[model samples]
Target: MKTLKIGLLGLGNVGTGTYEILAMNAAKISALTGCEIVISKVLVSNINKKRSLNLPADLLTENAADILSDPEIDIVVELIGGIHPAFDYMLTALQNKKHVVTANKAVIATLGDELMSAAAASNVLLKYEASVAGGIPILNALSTALAGNEFDEIVGIINGTTNYILTQMTDFGLNYDDVLKDAQAKGFAEADPSSDVEGEDVAYKLSILIQTAFGLKIPPLSIPREGITKVSKDDIAYASQFGYKIKLLATAKKNGSTLECHVQPALIPVSHPLASVSNEFNALFIKGNAVDDLMFYGKGAGSMPTGSAIVGDIIDIARKLDCLPCCLTPQISAPTKLIFAGEGKSMYYINFLVADVPGVLGKVSTIFGDHGISIESVMQRSKGKSEGEDVPVIYILHESSRQQLDPALAEISSYPFIKEVRSILRVEPLN
Candidate 1:
C-alpha cells in the first residue's frame, strides 16, 4: 500500500482529535483504504505549547510555509475555525496543487465556491464533510447518495451550543440566561457566544447545506435569521401546553423558482423525530422527491466525532489514489434566484403581555383580523386576578403568510397597552 501524507493546519481541539484518530487507527484505516495516512507536518500558533497528544517536536511548526510549501504534503487539512488566514492558507494549498479538506463552516459557507472552482481547475478535490453537523456525513449523503433526487426541504439543528442551551431550557424550565450560563460552564458554549446564540453559526451551516442539497451557493447573511436569545421559559412552557417543543431550527425549502431559507426558533411537535434530538445532538430533516423524508441524528460537534468526519474525508481521498473513482465529483450548479415570498405559511404562537383592560384583547384581535389572521387557540390569564397589571395572553394564529403577519405584529407591538411582545414561535405542521 502507498502512503498518503497530510499537512494539518491548527493543533487545537479538532486538530488534536484528527491526529489522535489517525495515530490510533493507523493500521485499521490503512487496511480499509489501502493507503497509510501520515501526518507529515502540523501548523500551530505555538510549537512549545502542551498538547493532549504526544508528538515529535519536529512535526510541529508555527509557520504555514512549513506545510504549504512542502511538496511531499499531498493533502492540506484545515481545522482552523475562521475565514481569514485559513482561507488564505487553503487557497495557497490549492494553488500548489494539493487536495484540500476543511472543517470550517464559516470558510466553506462563505468561500467554498471559490475554493471549489479552484479545485476543479486544478483537478484536485475539496472536501468538507465535517463543516456542518459534524461526523453525520449529511453533506456527503446529499452530494453522493441523494444527488439524483431533487429536494424540496432541508431543516436541521446544526449548532450544538445553541441546541444544548435550548435543550436545557426546555427540560429544566430554565430561562435563557440561566441555561446559557450553564451551557458556558459546561464548555458547550463560549464566554462570548454572540455568534452561536445570534444564529450566525447555524446560518453558515444552513448556507452550506443549501449549497450541497440544491447545488447553489449562497451568502450566510442572506438568510432570514433569528436566534434563540429571545426564547424564554414562557415560550417553552407555552409550546409544551400546545403539544410542541421549542427548538432553534435551520430551514430551507424550495418554492417553485425560489428557495425560502431561514434560521430561527421554531416549535416542533413534541412527538416528532426532531423534537427528540435534544441536548447537543443534531438532527437533519430532509424532504426529497424520491426519498420522501430522511432524518440524520448524531452528535453535532465534538472532538472525536468531528475528527472522525475529517478522517473519513482523508480515507475517501486515499482510497481513490491511482484507482477508479466510485463517488461522483461534486456538481457546482449555477446559482438561482432565492426568493422568500409565497412560501407556505405556518401556524404562529405569539405571547402578548398587554394592559389588564376591557378592550385590550379586542384591539389585538382587531389587528389580527385586519391582516386576515384568525386565532386557532387562545389562552389568557384570569380576568379578576389583577387590575391595571399586564395580562399574559397567548394566541395560536390560524395558518397565515409570514409576510402578512410581520406587519400586523409590528403594529400590535406599538400599542402603549402592549407591555411586551414576549415571544413569537412558528409552529411547523407535520408533512
Candidate 2:
C-alpha cells in the first residue's frame, strides 16, 4: 500500500485527539483506505509545551512552512480555531496543490467559497466535515448521501456550551447566571463565552448548513440571531407549564422564494426530538422533500469526537486519490436566487407585566386584534399585591410576523398599565 502523509496545524485539544487516533488506529485505517496514513509534521505555538500525547521532538515544529511547503505532505489538516493566520495558512496550502481539511467553522463559514474555488483551480479537495456539528457527519450526508433531495428546513442545537447551560437551567430550575457559572467550571463553556452565548457560533454553523443544504452563500452575520442570555428561570418554568422546553435553536427554512433563518432561544414542544437532546449533546433536524425528516444526534464538541470527524474527511480524500480532479471537485451549486427574510412568522410566547385591573387584558387584546395578532392561550398569575399593582401575564400568540408584533408591543408598552415586556420567544411548531 502507498503512504499518505499529513501535516497537522495545531496541537490543542483537537490536534492532540487527532494525533492519538491516527496512531492508535493506524492498522485499521490503513486497511480500510489502502494507504498508510502518517502525520509528517505538527505545527504548534510552542515546540516545548507539554501535551497529553508523547511524540518525538523531531515531529514537532514551530514553523508552518515545514508542513505547508513540504512536497511529501499530501494533506494539510488545520485545527487552528481562528480567522487570521489559520485562513492564510489554509489558503497557502490550497495554493500548493495539497488537499486541505479544516475544523475551523469560523474560517469555513466566512472563507469557504474562496478556498473551495482555489482547491478546484489547484486540482485538490477542500473538506470541512468537522466545521459544523462535530462528529455528526451531517455535512457529508448533505453533500453526498442526501444530495438528490431538496431540503426545506434545517434546525439544530449546534452550540454545546449554550445548550449545556440551557439544559441545566431547564432541568434543575436554575437561574441563567448560576448554570452559566457551572458550565464554565465544568469546562463546557469558555471564560469569555460571548461567541457561543450570544448565538454567533450557531449562526456560523447555520451559515455553513445553508451553503451545504441549499447551495446558497449567506453571510453568518446577516442571519438575525438572538442568544440565550435573555432566557431566565421564569421563562423555563413557563415553557414547562406549556408543555415545551427552552432551547437555543439555529433554524433555516425555505419559504417559496425566500429563505427565513435565525438563531435564537425557541420553545420546542416536549414531543419534538430536539427537546430531549440535553447537556453538551447536539441534534440536527433536517426536512427534505424525499427523505421527509431526518435527525442526527451525538457529542457536538469533544476532542475525540471532533478528531473523528477530521480523520473521516482525511480518509475520504485518501480513498479517492486516483479519481479525476474535475470529478473530485466539490459541487457547491450556483448561488440560489432566494430572498433572505429575518425570522418569519411563527407562534410566539410573549410574557409581560400588566396592572392588576379588569380592563387591561381586554385593552391589550384589542391592540393585538387591531394589529392582526391572535391569542392561542393566556395565563394570568396573581402576585398577591394590592389593587392596581402589576401582575405577570403570559400569552401564546398565534402566527404573527415581527413587523406586526413589534408595533403592537410598542403600543402596549407605552401604556401606564403595562409594566414590562419580560420576554418574547419563538414557538417552533412540529412539522
Candidate 3:
C-alpha cells in the first residue's frame, strides 16, 4: 500500500472539513483506495489563526511553494474558491506534474481550458467534482456516467442562497431583502451575496456543466442570466395563487446547432419535480436521449458536503494510480456555439404596476399584438390604495421568442400607464 500526499490550499470552511474528513476516516479511506491519503501541507492566509479543526501547526504554511513546489506531494486539493492566486497555484501544480482537485468553480468555469490543457500536457488528472453542486457528484455523472448519452437539457436549482431566499419568500411571503437577511443570519449567504443572489454563482456552475456535458467551453458571460434580486412578494403570492412556485432556475438546452443557456427566476408548476426543491437544497434535472430523465439532489453547499466531493476526486486520482476507484473518467473539452438571449423561446411571466384606468390594459394588449407576444393569462389586482392609482398586473404568456417580447415589453415599460416593471421570469412548462 502506498501513502499519497495531499497539499491543501486555503484552509477555510471547506479546507477544514477536508482535513477533518481525511484524518477521521483515514483508515477506512486508505482501505478503500489501497493508499493512505495524507495532508502533508496546507496553504493558509494566516497560519497562526485559530482553526476549527486541530492539526499540527507545522502543516500550515502561507507560501504556495510549500505545496506547489513540494516534491513529495502527489495531489494538491485547492478549496480557495476564487480565480487569482488559486488559479496560478493550481496551474503551477499541474505544470509540476501533480494531480489537482479543486472546488473553485470560478477558476474551473473561467480558466478550465488553460488548466485542462495543462493537465493533459502533464498527463495528470485535474478533477473538480466539488466545483459544481457541492457534493452532488453531478460533474462525474455528466463527464463519466452519462457520457454515453446525448444530453438534450439540463435544468437545475444550483444556487443554495438564492433558493433559500426564494423558499423563505414563498413560504413566509417575505420580500427579497428580508429573506436575504435571514439567509445571512443563518449562514446560508455570504456578507456579499452578489455572487449567489445575483445569479453569478449559478451561472458559473452552469457553465462548468455545459462544457462538461457538450464538451464545449462557452464563456460564462455568454450564458445570459438574471438574478432573483428583482423577485418580490407579490410575484410569489401570484404564483402560489396560480398553483405554481418560483425558483431561480439555471437552464441549458440544445436547439438544432445552438445551445440555449440562461439563469433567471422561473415560474414552475408545483407538481414538477424541480418545483418541490426548497431552502438551500439543490437539484439538477438532467434529460438525456438514453437516460430519459435523472435528478441528482443534495445539500448543494456546506463544508462537509463540498469536502466530501473534494476527497472523492482525490480518491479517483489515487485510483488512477491503480488504487481501484469506482470509476475513473476524465473531462474532455471541445467547442460549440450557444444562442444569444432573446433568440430562444419559452413561456414567460411579467408582473408590472400600471395605472388602474380604462384603456391601459388595451394599450398593453395592443403593444403585445404589435410584437406578436401571445398572452396565455393575465391577473389584475388592486393594491386598494386609490382609484386610478397603480395596481399590480401579472401576465403569463404562451411560448414566445424573446425577439417578440423584448421590443413589446420595452415599449410597454415606457408607457405612462405602466408605473413599473415589477418582475419578469420565464415559465418552465410542465412536461
Candidate 4:
C-alpha cells in the first residue's frame, strides 16, 4: 500500500488525542483505507516543550514551512483554534496543492468561500468535518446522506459548555455564575469563556450549519443571538412550573423565499428530545421534506470526541488521494434567491415584578391588547407577595413578532406598578 504522510499543526488536547488515535488504531485504519497514514511532522510554538505523548525529537519543529512547503506531505491537519495563523497556514497549504483538513469553525464560518475556491483551483479537497458539533458526523450526513432532501429547519443544542451550565441551573437550581465557575473548574469551559457564554461560539457553528443544510452563507455576527448570562434560578423554576426547560438553542428555518435564523435562550417542552440532553452532551433536530424529522445526539465536545472527528476527516481524504479533487462549489455558494429574514414570530415567556394590586394585570392586558398581542397563560403566586411588597408575575404570550411585542413592553415598563422585567425568552414549539 502507498503511504499518506500528514503534517499536524498545534499540539494541544485535541492534537494529542489525534496522535494517540492514529497510533492506537494504525493497523485498522491502514486495512480499511489501503494506505499507511503517518504524521511526518508537527508544528508547535516551542519544540523543546515536553509533552505527555511520546513524540520523536525529529518530528517536532517550530517552523511551519517544513510542513506547508514540503512536497512529501499529503495532507495538512490544522488543529489550531484561532483565525490568524491557522487561516494563513491552511490557505498556504491549499495554494501549495496539498489537501487540507481543519477543525477551526471561526475560519471556516468567516472565510470558507475563499478556502473552498482555493481548494477547487488547486485541485485539492478542503475537508472540515470536525468544525461544527464535535464527534457528530452531521456535516457528512448533510452533504452526502441527506443531500437529496430539502431541509426545512435545523434546531440544535450545539455548545456543550453553555448546555452544561444551563443543565446544572435547571437540575440543581444553581445560579448562572456559580454553574459557570463550576464548568470552568471542571474543564468544560475556558478561563475567559466569553466566546461560549456570550453565544458567539454557537453563532459560528450555526453559520456552518446554514451553509451545509441550506446552501446559504450568512455571516455569524448577523445572526441575532442572546446568551445565557441573563438566565437565573428564578427563570428555571418558572419554566418547570410551566412544563418547559430553558435551553440555549441554535435555530434556522426555511420559509418560502426567506430564511430565518437566530441563537437564543428558549423554553422547550419537557417532552422534547433536546430537553433531556443534559450536561455536556449535544443534540440536533432536523426537519427534512423527505426524511421527516431526524435527531442526532451524542458527546459534542471533548479531547477524544473532537480528535475522532479529525481522524475521520483524515481517513476520508486519504482514501480519495488518488482520485480527482471533489468540487465544493455547491457547498460554499451564497443564497442568491432566498431572502434572509432575521427572526420570525414565536411564543414568548415574559416575567416581571409588579405591585401586588388588583388592577395591574388588567392594565398590562390592556397594553398587550392595544398592541394586538394575546396571552396564552398567566401565573402568579400569592405565597411570595406580602401585603405591601411587590410580587413576580409570569406571562406566556401567544405567537407574536419582536416588533409587535417590544412596543407593548415599553408601554408597560412606564407604569408605576411595574418594578422590573425579569426575563423575556422564546417558547419553541417542538411538536
TM per candidate comes to 0.95, 0.98, 0.95, 0.97
Stretches of candidate 1 exceeding 4 Å from the true structure: 324-331, 334-344, 383-385
The count of backbone overlaps in candidate 3 is 0
Backbone clash pairs for candidate 1 read none
Per-residue C-alpha lDDT of model 3 across residues 1-431, encoded as one tens digit per residue = 78999999988989988888888788889988899888999999887888777688588998899899989999999988788999999999999999999999999999988998898788788999898999899988887778888888999999999999999898888889988887889888999999898889998999899888876666887778889988889899998887789999989888887787888889999999999899989999999999999999998889899989998888878877863332332466544565433227899898988888888777888789788887888888985667766798888888888778888889998988888888778898948
Residue 204 lDDT in candidate 4: 98
Residue 183 error, candidate 2, Å: 0.8
Off by over 4 Å in 3: 323-330, 334-343
Model 1 vs. true fold: TM: 0.95
- Model 3 residue 95 CA deviation in Å: 1.0
Backbone Cα, N, C clashes tallied per candidate: 0, 0, 0, 0
Q: lDDT of each structure?
A: 0.87, 0.91, 0.86, 0.91
- Model 4 clash pairs are none
RMSD of 1: 2.1
Off by over 4 Å in 2: 383-389
